[model samples]
Target: MGDYHVRFCESLGVKFPLATRLEAKQIEPGAAVAPKTYRFETLWMALNQTNHERYTETNALEQEKLLDKILVGNCLSFFKSLDIFVEA
Candidate 1:
């Protein structure tokens, strides 16, 4: 997961801010293919690391699970899982 975070940070040219948000319009050329790549990294984080950020601890793992499903284009599973991890 640390490796995933490193790659994600490098991709976005930003430090690992656990709860950072990246909208599509905010994506730079450096971020080409990064959305998918980051989804992969987030999946890895959820599957392998402990959640530490105050903003993420509530549903971090579930978010990753949904991300993985969505990235794979599994719409049904994605929505099903998404409902479980909605942020407060």
Candidate 2:
């Protein structure tokens, strides 16, 4: 998952700040069992610019401690969405 995030981020020229699987579970014991995509809260979308840039540049090792706050806030805002095609 770390590799995937790194590759994905590199392809887009952006930083990857998500927690690794083990770190995520440690941060929220049952997070591993949740859906791959999370539903972020409104306040997560409301952080200020300076704070956002600071977290985005924070070292990946230290970022783990801030992952839940940082990633959930920016994932939807930062990433492009794909239009999935479902076969009828």
Instruction: Give Cα-based local distance difference scores for all models.
Output: 0.50, 0.53
Name the top TM-score candidate. Answer: 2
**Which segments of model 2 are wrong by more than 4 Å?**
1-43, 67-88
Model 2 scores what on Cα lDDT? 0.53
lDDT, candidate 2, at 80: 32
Error of 1 at 67 (Å): 0.4
| RMSD vs true structure, all candidates | 13.5, 13.3
Q: Write the residue-wise lDDT of candidate 2 on 51-73 in tens digits.
A: 66776898987666676666654
Minimal lDDT window, size 10, model 2: 22-31
Q: lDDT score of model 1?
A: 0.50
Q: List model 1 lDDT by residue over 1-88, tens digit each.
A: 6678679768978775454565456532221343342334333333333323433555768766655654445534455564633222
